[model samples]
Target: MTKTRIMIALVVLLAGLKSNGQEALFGGQEIVSPEINKDKSVTFRLLAPAADSVFITGDFLPTTKMKTPMGEMDAPGKKLLSKNGEGLWTYTTEPLASELYNYSFIVDGMTVRDPNNPFVIRDVSSLTNIFIIGGGKADNYKVNDVPHGTVAKRWYDSPGLGMDRRITIYTPPGYEDSKEEYPVLYLLHGAGGDEEAWMDLGRTSQIIDNLIAEGKAQPMIIAMPNGNVTQDAAPGMGSDGFYKPVFMAPKTMDGTYEANFMDIIKFVENNYRVKANKENRAIAGLSMGGFHSFHISRYYPNTFDYVGLFSAAIMPREDATGEVYNNINETLEQQYKNGLELYYIAIGKTDFLYKANQDLKKQLDEIGMPYEYVETDGGHIWRNWRIYLTDFAPKLFK
Candidate 1:
């Protein structure tokens, strides 16, 4: 063909491809799924013309009671989305409070994530779309125009577990540039979570960054270690490759993880520029991780001057047997004797472990052990956990 003919053909082909790409992406007109309004009421839109019905369910909605094997509990309520003439389904929530919320779409009985919303978080086995309502407590969770910290996933040798493990570390702003040695906080995750949990689900980095910038908290290093003893890291992130995650895993609450806790501290102290003493060391966790913190701090009596437990699972398994699990009272007695700056415990009012935490408080009272207790409204949820962290961090290393 001639040169002009070839140029004309190329132009035609490129134009066709561009048209098809736009059609595939937006289906003719652009669709913005989540549009945060000025009134704080969120409008969710989905382009599902062929679907018979559509509904939206999320943590922002009011909860209802649902029966499960454990017992009757509260679950996020579902709201029906009205279909538009163009097949665009939409629903607008009432003015929501400032907090982070996750939701999913139920289209024709199949549950799926919001295709237009790229922000999502994974909790164990499930993934859902997430959004933050600014102007309140959730503002701390959002990434703002502040001096940010560095988040890194580093691997370290764990001889006790007989495998290399991965941990997420957050070094505050100016850490690399400064020669200062900072205090260390060993943060842990619950069952079915890995090093990625606190960073993603709990918004640890963002919260800490905001708190530091606002002068509410001090600059420090946060080391988030995987609590699961059998796995080296999160699924698809470990040496075992990808696998399905479950709510419960073997050796989760066993004494093995607590006994080997020093390995993590050793790795952090050796690798990072941190203050290597009990007074500069702190530990905290949520759910299963809280249980681990409760046991590990006591096991290592004089290691940590600050400890926090949020919605902790207080009791171990019936068959759990080990020296770490045994002599809990004696260990706690020693921990108190060593002198702690802060022994903080926070939980939801309706949490499943409420009674257990009460029992623990009673035991501490009988021993005349001092601790700061906080009770908020909710169950075993991330909302309460984030609040607890926000409250507890301000009181650290002071």
Candidate 2:
């Protein structure tokens, strides 16, 4: 080859190598000159792996709803470059929104973490890169000098599950000051969640603090527990055919969890100045927690007066089967007459459990059970759950 030809070939090879190079651990792909256009269009380029398809899944796109037909991430707009032999790929697309969004890349049926972005967030499954399009409400999450609840990490022995577990409890402000008894709310978490799920991911304490300070919610003790009933049911049970942590199932029952939860309640009442009565106690949760709240409050009617279900997994009477059929009616009847004071059920419009929660409302109506049903924006996510707790707390123990 001539000198000019050789120089051109070398430059081309170097560019190819640069594009196909292995990305750093914290940097997966780059969105070259990501910008919001004058036409209200946001555009960016994605550098991906070779021989792979890249789909941009984020909150801005309606096609990204969870568990829907169009939810699967597919290649966006056009392919910027073919996957080189070195396993590198790149693409670009223009989305409609400029707001901050949470997204991920689905490469060959596996969700790969974003390497280019330093901000990482975790759901039940894996961590993904977080991107902010337009600036958001950062002041909302900042911890102010407001009176905050004290979080206690306590350990308890569970005879039901045959294991010792740890739980986190948040004592509301002035819990130690007044000798007067206070009410308690037991907040349960969903599958693949732990005791810290509410405090860490849901930010339940902050929501409660803000609501109570604003006089929108009453000050109450929030007891968050590890809701798993079996050894295999705890968080991090992947690769066991159960991709997500299993919810309440008959096959996984251990008698000790409910008893242990009660023990915690009793302990709180005895150790602290709590009301310690059914009228002052409440139980609520999301997903698996919702199922637990429904089942536990139903079975132990004398324990809790207020019950809230956020994106509950329990189906309606028409769709009930086996164990659900046997207990739902009885549970509804008990909740209607004497067991519960206020039964609250709320689910997001886009949540997968929306239809199920709606069916549950219908079942409650058919059985003459009284309840407050609410549907809101967002899905079965922390944003909704946090808002659920914020809205649900003021109505308790009033």
Candidate 3:
């Protein structure tokens, strides 16, 4: 064979080797390196099969329903580029000031993961790639040698609800060292979750231990309660109707959470060695827990000095009625003037609750209520809530 033919054969062999032994090609798409610039802008490229819409979705960007529409692509400081025949899509985003973000792709209305990024986090059954930027106070939220807190599973009977409920509580590292009374943060679990959700999945104790040891966060007791309100929604609900009736309601407003949640708080304060005053008391939760926080704190403003809602499900003005609305309006007005010390609302950009949170912020803004609104990365996942607690706890009792 001639030299040219030999060279052609060699090139074909190399291509065959790469195709057979190397990369796993899924829909012929591979994510290239994602680069973060000094301006905090992130530029990432993905090689994929030519499709109608190859939109990039992440914690920084809104979740697109159908990939092709790419509605409102002109997000401030965002740019998209695609090659004609190569099927390479590149995206450049504005400087994201968050510490962590999770994202995925929408191809023709179907959500898919980035093949290149190895760091993926699971949200229920779906998975998304995560990217972190601008490391903030949450850098110290790992397990450490500081006086570690202990997580215990405690059971309780709710007479009003006529059910036996279980709860998880975390005692600060030095609870046994001295008889000093500590403030307590009543954390609530979200929909489709149970009492042990915060400790088992959210890692409340570990985060607290690390934060307290580093002195970045205060050492306090955290009580995590089951936020499910349906009588059949305890851990082993056999029927689907008992799963999430609140979410399925006509307006998605939970009317049953207020009474049961208050009972749990009363139980914690009365039984535990917690400070009884509002200044030393707080309430916070995620998703459904967030709904509980907003409802509980607004109803019983004098009972808590700090209120945090992570991706809270704020009830619409039309939905609020009866005692719930009257209490929320009165309490919000009073708290706005008296100052609750801390009123925080945090949600991820890609989360479905982001727009709702923004709407709630707007309402608070209209009322001149003083509260912190944080937009971070990742959807409605425990990872985002864990980070929120880490940042939020230190700001309390200070």
Candidate number of the best lDDT? 1
After superposing candidate 1 on the true structure, give the runs of residues whose Cα lies further than 4 Å from its correct spot. 1-23, 26-29, 66-73
Residue pairs of candidate 1 with colliding backbone atoms: none
Q: What tens-digit string does per-residue lDDT give for candidate 2 at 3-99? A: 9999999888767656754444324333432445666454544454443565555555554322422122222121233455545454344545433
Candidate with best TM-score: 1
What's the C-alpha lDDT at position 390 in model 3? Answer: 80
- Model 3 Cα lDDT, one tens digit per residue, 181-241: 8899999777656566676556677778887887877778898876654433333332343
Query: Looking at candidate 1, what is the lDDT of residue 216?
Result: 93
Any idea what lDDT model 2 has?
Answer: 0.65
- lDDT per residue, candidate 1, 1-398, as tens digits? 99999999999877776665325634433567788999999999988889999999999888887774334556888999999897889999999999999999999999999888888999988999999999999999999999999999999999999999999999999999999999999998987788999999999999999999999999999999988889898899988888898777788777899999999999999999999999999999998899999999999999999999998888757746877888888989999999999999998987878888999999899878999999999887899999999999888998
- The stretch of ten residues in a row with the least summed lDDT in candidate 3 is 68-77
Q: What are the C-alpha RMSDs, in order, of all predicted structures?
A: 2.4, 8.3, 8.9
Clashes of each: 0, 11, 0
TM-score of 2: 0.68
Ranking the candidates on lDDT from highest down gives 1, 3, 2
